[model samples]
Structures are given as C-alpha cells and as structure tokens.
Target chain A: MRARIVDKNDILKIVDILRKDHEVIAPFQGRGRDSFFDVVTDANRDQVKMHLHNPYYPPKRYVLPHIEKLFDIDQAKMDVKAAYVEPKRAIFGIRSCDVHGIYHLDRFYLGRDYKDPYYERLRRGLFLVNVVCTDKELDIDNGCFCMCANTGPASTEHFDLQLMDLGDVYMAVAGSPKGEALFADPIFKRGDDSHVQRRRSILNEVRKHFKLAVNWYSAAVRYITTGQVPEELWAQVGNRCLECGACTYLCPACTCFTVADRKVDGKVVERVRLWDSCALSGFTRMAGGHNPRRAVHDRRNRRFFRKLAHYFVQRELSMACVGCGRCIDVCHGDIGMPSVVEIIRRGCAGKENDSTIIKR
Target chain B: MTQPSSNDKNIYLPKVAILDRVQDEIQEVKTFFWHFENPADQEEFKKFRPGQFAQVSIFSQGEFPASLPPSPTEKETFFTVRTVGSVTSGLHQLKAGDKFAVRGPYGNGFPMEQYYGRNLVFVAGGIGLIPLRSCIIYALANRDRYKKIQVFYGSRSPRELMYTQNLREWEKIEGFEFYTTVDRGDADWKGNVGVVGSLFKKPDVKVPVENTTAFVCGPPIMFRFVIKDLKDMGFHDRDIVSTLERYMKCGVGKCGHCCIGMAYVCTDGPVFTYEQIKKLGEDI
Candidate 1:
C-alpha cells in the first residue's frame, strides 16, 4: 500500500528477494563500453549500475527485438500458419525517456483491429524497474533536449517499480500489482515520501543543467508539412551528415528496419529483420538499381521529414525524434542533431552561406 | 502503456494455394489459376477486385506481388505472369494441382464505382495488360452501365503480345472498341504495326473528359508518354487513373519498401489518379 527502502547493505537481499518472483535483469558491462542486461547475482552489484540512465539500446530489445520470425508462409501453397513467441523478465535501471519510447511504440502497434502478436507477447512477459536520475555524471552542458520533449529521468508513469536514490538508501515505489507483489517481500521496509521529495528536487536540479533544447514541440510534423524547404538547405546540412546511421541505432524510439531473407539448407526461407535507416543511400533502391533519393542531401532531408514529417501525416504526432542524445553522442562527423537544427534554422533565416566549411 | 503489438511480424506469413490451371498465353507470359486448399479462403478469394494483386510465392523461388488476372466478376480466379524472375520462373514450371502461397488482394484498386456514369478508356502496355484484364472484363460484364468502352493495347512486338484469344473475344462484345499495335510486326501480322500510343491517334477514340475515366498501366516510360498524349487530348488528370508497380515487401503499410516519396504504394495506392500522383514528387 505504501513504499519501502533498499539500503546499501541490503542490496544483495533486495536483488535476491526480487529474483524470487521475477527474472531480474540488471545492466552490466558487457564488453568495453557496451552495456547489456545480465542476471543480477549477489556478487555483481558493482557491475549492475542501476543508477545509470538509458543504456546503448532502449529496453525495447526485451520486447520488440531486431530480428524476430513472423509466421512462415508456404510459397508453393498459399496457406498461412500463425507463429507465437514470448519471454518473461524484469528490467532494472530503465530511464523515463526510454519508457516513453516504449509507450510511443505501444500506441503505434497495440490494441487495434489488427494486433502485433510478437510485440504483444513480449510486452506481456516483462516488468519495468525504473531508476530516477540522481547521478549527474554525464555532462548536460551540451543542450540535451529531452527536457524540452517532456521526457526525462523523472518518472512519468509506465514503470512497475521506480527506485529513487537517497544518500544511503534507494527508495522504491511499486507502480503496478506485479511491482507491489515483489515489494511485499521482507527484504524491503516501508519508507517516507520525504525521501522521494528530496530525490525529486535533485532530479529537478539535474534537468536544468542540460544545454540542448529543440524549442519546437512538433518539429517532425512542422518539418513535414513545410515541404519543399529548398535543396540548398539539405545540401548545407548534408555536408555535415556523415551518412552514418548511428543516430538511428542509438535512438530509443527509432524503429525503421530491413527484412533479410536467409536460406536454411537451401530449402527454407528465413526472413530476418535488421534495423534500417532512411539516411542511408540504399534505403529505397529498386531491383534494377534505381534510387529515388539519389543524393545524400535528399536523404538528409528525407531522414528528418520521415521522423518529423512523413509519419506525422498519418500518426498526427512526429515519429521523427524522441529527443534522445544518442545521435549526438554517436555522430563521428560532429554534425549531429544540434548542428542539423542550426543549419536548417540559419538557412531558413536567409544566411545564404554555404555549410561546406566543417567546424572544429 | 502496453508494448506495441508485433502485428507487423504477421505480414511475412504466406498462405498456401493450389494451382488449378495454367494457361500459356504468349512466348514468355503464362496465366495461373489457383485456389486455396483451405476451402473457406477460396470463397474469400472469389471476392477480390479486378486491379488488386496478390503476393504469390513459389516454394524455394522467392515471392513477388502479381496482379490478379481474372475479373472479380468472373467465377474463375488466376494470375498472369511474364516469367521474368526466379519466382515467376518457378511458377512457370508448375503444372495444375501444384501449390504455392498467396497473400493479399492488396493495394487500392481501380475506382470502379466512380467510372459508372463515365466513359471508360483502358490503356495498357505489354504485360501491363494483366492487371487491366480484370477491369476490361468487369466493364464488359456490366457493359450497359458505362457509355463508352475503349481499350488501346501496345506491345514491343507481335510475339510479345498477351491474351491473343481474349483480345479477339473482346472485339465481339458490343460497344467495345479494341485496338492494338506492335512496335515490330511479323510477316503474318495484319494488325496496326506501331507503338500502342499510336492507337490513341485513331479519331474514333472517345474522350468525353468531363464524364470519362481512363485506366493506364504499363512500363514507366510508356506511362509518361501516354499521359502526355492523354493530357494533350484534354483529359483531366483526375480522370486518368493508373496502377503503379514498385518493390513491395509487406502489402500492408509497415514494410516501407513501396514508399514513393511520402506515399506508401501498398497502402495509399497501387492505383492512384494523376491528380493524386502529381503532388507526390517523382515518378510513381
């Protein structure tokens, strides 16, 4: 009915207690800087960084995986057989923006005349354990725009259990029945809202430290509806674009993908879904080698419009971006989100200047 | 919030279809009439429209979306293929009683209802005749509803022309004016020997543009030339409808392969009027 605190000394008791009812998956260093979810064993608390923000990929991998087999269709005989797959687990240390990313995906896929059985099955078998932001180690001076998008480290619903960091203990509140059942174990003891409020104030202080801001509420939609925004603008931003799809790869909400057909034993056709980005030159190639968006400038424009414009036409909301800084962090060209916006804005402001000069 | 359903995963699923009949039309082209071994789906397949196509798959040969060749109005169902790829080639090897997989009657078909009071002009090139075959049959089946029916068929050569028997049969139908031509003619050829676009030059061709609908399906180059001819003849862009063919993976909107600019060919159209297409930037 209330909340509890898992203290520094009780970390083992808490993970062991939580693992009783749920398959506890916590973030651990996989290889080098790459992070992955692993079973939370007692000796691995140092490896389990629960206070960290969203990892390399969103927790979406637990739900909508990159490659999943849909039902197999017999080509010779036009007969369809339904395929089903499901896995159950609990995730620890998910950030709020990543949670919202899953939420956006839900609205796009679930509860309709047609349902995504794979995503639905994966969603059904998981619990979300979110950690509120208290550690401000990642420098926010570079204008990360998550705050402007109204998604942040602070909880905005969707988590089953939310952990708020205090000086010596982690305050936990169960947001769902599953969370409630897990917290009812003796490993957790009832705590007060004062700790939550204190943590909340800390998160508020952390939010303001960010330097990035995308002022437009519906940048995706606006960009799409404002079609034909001159080729020069794209060429300007296009020059800076490294043509690498790192932004798409690290995005919490980016879901564009490709389907690859693999032959097993030269008899079976295995369709594998791999992540695809419109930013790539080969994204829309036809059989005889005709690419509609031939130029990188055109692709640059398309990538932005697809997120901000195209999907906006149908979904009303811009599916273009989720204000995640993954694109910023991963861009080798230094022509990531902040620069893209600035070039477009400056071009729109009649700068008549060329974007060819790469800035240091 | 709930996780998004992986409904998209279902699109790759194929359906089994047993081949009932195969008709070799031209040198390269053949028509396969197939039905579901599952009897209930056979009934649903019977209800497919004239222009909508099916994503047909031949075992171990890959899958491609082929136009439904038979008129929905007709009791028989089939698909016409111009054996160009591995899937179609595999399909070519199959005999009656063999089976394959099929998904759809996908894409926006020709607006049959809108053509009710209007004169219907059907323009097709080479194998593009396959999709138009359904519409031609439908218009002929219900010939009394429309004022005029004119079909202009074109091909690269005399031997490449498809539906020779049906083309002759279509001539016998009252109120139907059927004209065809070949870019290159054989010694025995008695018909007009020129590009199919030349057939539109015939003065008998009617263009009551205000109350007329034209269906165009062909190679992209032919489409452009024929459209310019239609526009020159004062046919309004809205009155000119064409079926587009692009690389389509999922017949549903999600797969993203058939996107032409912002338009998804699988969902928004495989059939779009010129009025709709002019705004979409680039060739459909």
Candidate 2:
C-alpha cells in the first residue's frame, strides 16, 4: 500500500497522540555533547530534540535496566513471586544502528529458555518511530561505522514507522501493522510517487555521507586471535585504557550483567540485576576470596575480547560493536576501539610503530 | 560432596528450607541444620557427595557459602551453616519450620576414589574445618579403603573449636590421629598449644610425597602460610586440593559471580590445586 507523509514540525504532535496509550520516549540532549533518550512529556517539549546523533547510551538500558529487581520472596510464607512490571512506551527517533542493537537483545533475551521478563515487558511496549540523521557533523562525530558493520544508515526490521526527512516534510513509511494503523489517523495523509522517491534519495544520501571506514570482519577476527601479537602493542593500546565500561554500556550488542540480593527486614528480598562490566576488578571474585583478572589491563583486554573475539565469533554474527563510538567520547583516556583497531592493523602488518603513530 | 554431575540444570534451584536445628560452635559462629518441607526435595538431596556445598539464601539478608556437613551417605538431609554475616546471624534465630532457600551441591569436591590409597592429610583452621569435616568423616567410615588418616585442626582459642563432641568421638577411632591445637591455650586446656602448622614439627607423622593427598581450608591468611609449608615439605601443588570461597550467586557457571577468568569456581572447581590457581592470575 501507499505510504503516508507528515511534516517535520508535527512529529511532536504524533508523540502527543501516542502518549495517551503509551509512555512516549524521545531523544533529549543531556549534559555535555551527549544525547540520551528521555521520556517525552509536555514539561520537556524544548528539551526533546527529534534530530540528533545517537545517544550516550543505547535504548537497551530502558529495556534491560542497569539495576532491576527481578523477583521478590516472602520470608514468612516461603513463597516467591516475580517482580513483573509492564510500562507501555513509545520510542521515537531511534537511529538505525540502535534498532539493530535492540534486535540483538531481542534474540538474546527471547531466544533463550530463561526469558528476561523485565526486558520483554518494555520491549513488547516499545513502538519505534525512526528519523533520518540529516546532519553530517552528527554522522561523523557520532562515529557510526554502519556501512562496514552492515547494519544500516537505516533499518529494515524492528522499527514501526520509518521517518526519512526530505527537508520540508518527512515521508513516513509504515513498516509494520501498528505503523499502518498509526498512519491511518487524521494527522497523516496518503503520499504521491515523488515523496517516496525523495525518501529513497535521502536514505541514499545518508549512506553516501557515512564516515570512518572499517574492515569489520578483519577487525573482529584480529581482535579475537590477536593474542600472538605482542603485549607491547596492547601495552601501548592499554596505556590509553581508562578502564571505563562505557564501551560495553553504549554498544547496542553488549549484554553482560550481575545480580545482587537486596534485603529488607531480615528476609530473602529481591534479586537486583545490574549492568556488570568485566573491566571491573571484582567481576571474577569467588566466595572463598579468589579474584582472577585482578589487574586493570587484563580486565580491559577481556572487554575487547568479549565483544570482538568471543561472543561475536562464537555467535558467527558481527562483533557486538555497533560502532556507536560512545566509548570514544566517554573514555577520558582516549583508548577506544577505533584507535585499538588501527594498532591491530599496524601489528598485523609487522610494523614496530607506537601509539603516537596511530594518533596521527 | 562429589562434584555436581549429569543431573539437569533444575538441580540448582534455590528452594525454601526450614531451619530444624542449630548448634553454636563459638562466639561468632553457629551451625544450622535445615530440611526441605516441600517433601519432594527430601528425595533430591540423595545425590550430593561429601565436600559439596550449597548457596544458603536468607531473603533480603544475603546468600553465603556453607558445606554439607552431613554426609550424602546419610538418608536424612541437612546443611551445616556458620553464622559470619548478617544473613548468618539472622539464621541463628531461625528454628524448626522456619524457611530459607538454598542453591547447590555446586563445585567439585575432594576426589575420594582417586585418594583412596593415598595417605590423607587434612589441615584446617577455625571454621575452615566444616567443609573438610565431611571428607574426614567419610574417609573414617570407609577406613579400609584408604591409607594413614590424620587431621591437624587449629582454632583461635579453645572456645572456638567446632564439632568438639564429634571430634572427641573421632579421636577414639584406631589409626586416626585427631591433633587439635589452639593459637593460645587457656589455663584449663591440656592439648597441643600452637598453630595447626605446628603439627609438622612432630617427626613420626611424616607423609610420603608420592602417595599423599592433602586438603586445606581456612581464612586466606592461614591457607597462605599452610600451603607454603606443605610445598616446602615436598608436596606438589596438584597433590593438595583446597576448596575456594567466592561470591557465587548462581550455582551454575552462567552468573559472573564465581568466575575466576575462564574458570567458574561453581563449575570448574571450588577444589583446585596451586597449579590451577597460578594460571588464573587472581589472588587467592
């Protein structure tokens, strides 16, 4: 069927419509230069920006919360009940790369026998309304290596309404039944041939402008098997390692967590699940007081291996790096994956260059 | 107990258990024996071996590692817990029909069959003796299957000694030497007065290196000194097996809690050699 069109200015109005039935979340620029998705309400109209680069953290945080209470137990009765929460949310302005990340999480959480009810709850509620990244500075500074990673400057799955901006008006293609139903409302109108052609050209332009080229498969392979390479190289790379877990936090595909049992009133309380990074020192501690990977550098190496070498290689999917580059900006040490990949390439070429060579 | 085996994943479920018995071993330590009221699990406890442990879950309080002081050979079921933290102290108040949850029979236990013919050296300090107590009693029961048996136990003071009555019963057995020591002796005490490591000073109990299997457990400081002494006394790292304590939230290897690099203490071992610990690059 023919798609519908809506003016760029009226995007917030659509959000107002969805808020009646769901909690509408949109991109709101937070402190510094970073953008994060915040729930859309009338109070933050000026704060919500529909057209911006990817956020400091992916949408995964909302679905898979950093700290979640999984289940609660009653000490007196000895009966246990799951802490189930269902908040209906409409996620507006999701970038294509973030959508791909949510897709991976969908498979990880839903594909397994033990389903994460918390993630599944928000996931089922989330309605995607994706917008095009028209700003080149947003594309470059964002550090999204989408083409090499082969996710997209646009997504084909997961998203409901795909909004491609054509300067004045936006061509809104209804990718799913929900999108079609939403489009059938009074606000949107049926589009002509030229509008659809305009969206095709706009998407093509976004893809043409994508910067930061990478050999994704080679980069992933090298990251896992890069052990034979010298520690001096990793030392040079490791020197920049800030030991911050931002890379895993921002990446759309990174999913490792830890659980803590929080007590209340001397009873077996709730199982609180939090985002855990292997970069932390206590990540591998056993009860009898044994900690493996005690060094900061080894933990740093483990994060890289987990994303590029381990989970991705084993799953035979692209390395979990969505090329979001939140790690680059978040890292105070300036030792993100892009610089690490350059070092890997240099090492693979057998050149004895240091960190200074990669910087230039 | 013998390490968790081919039973399916559900074996690790944390179920509510009632505290049926409690025994105070020392000022800060108490042992609790519990049973599953669900009736079905009363049968499930049949498979665990000596030296295996469970993650005792005290709701809202926290979970801690405690070994099955009762042998798997016993048809009756219970776990012996020592009160060390808030969760454990809370457990001391629990009595018959009071419920708590437990997840395990996790991690590898002492290799009983492999150590059958070897002289067994059990070196324990304070409550470290709890996990080792099962193996000691099991070996004592099957006395004919093993070689020389000896236990070198030490506690902070005479008051801190656990299972004293049981230790006395074990003392009366022939060919079994239960050498008890205290860091400092009280006026009424009339036993060896020194660290358990002092037992090595006596010459007649020298164990041959080739046919000796030693098991050690205690606070990290005690294990540090004791392991060094054993290595110095011609024992290889592999010949000595020690149970490790780490924060293991899930008895299965999936949770990152009990991980030591690639090794999950819940899966690969709670019992390991110095050789395995060396590759981990982690502190013990």
Best by lDDT: 2
lDDT per residue, candidate 1, A174-210, as tens digits?
Answer: 7888888777677688777787787777777887666
Clashes of each: 23, 18
In the range A1-360, model 2's lDDT, one tens digit per residue, is 336778877867788888889888889876667677888877896677767767777788778888877677766677666666778887888887777778778765666444555677778878888766666766446466766666677666678887767788877778789888887677687778888788778777776676666644474355345344465665676667666677666667767777777775575567777787776667766443456556676667666655566434455345666666667777777767676666676665644356635776
TM-score per model over all chains: 0.86, 0.69
Q: Which segments of candidate 1 are over 4 A away from where they belong?
A: A1-18, A30-33, A39-46, A72-83, A111-113, A138-143, A166-196, A215-220, A236-244, A266-269, A280-282, A310-318, A350-360, B1-10, B193-195
Which lDDT value does model 2 have at A97? 76
The number of the candidate with the highest TM-score is 1
Give Cα-based local distance difference scores for all models. 0.71, 0.72
Deviation from native of the Cα of residue B152 in model 2, angstroms = 3.8
Off by more than 4 A, model 2: A1-51, A85-142, A145-271, A276-321, A335-360, B1-14, B49-51, B75-84, B93-97, B108-121, B139-150, B175-182, B185-201, B211-213, B229-239, B248-255
| Best model number under DockQ | 1
Give me the chain B TM-score of candidate 1: 0.92
Evaluate model 2 with DockQ and give the value: 0.21
Model 1 chain A worst lDDT window (10 residues)? A351-360
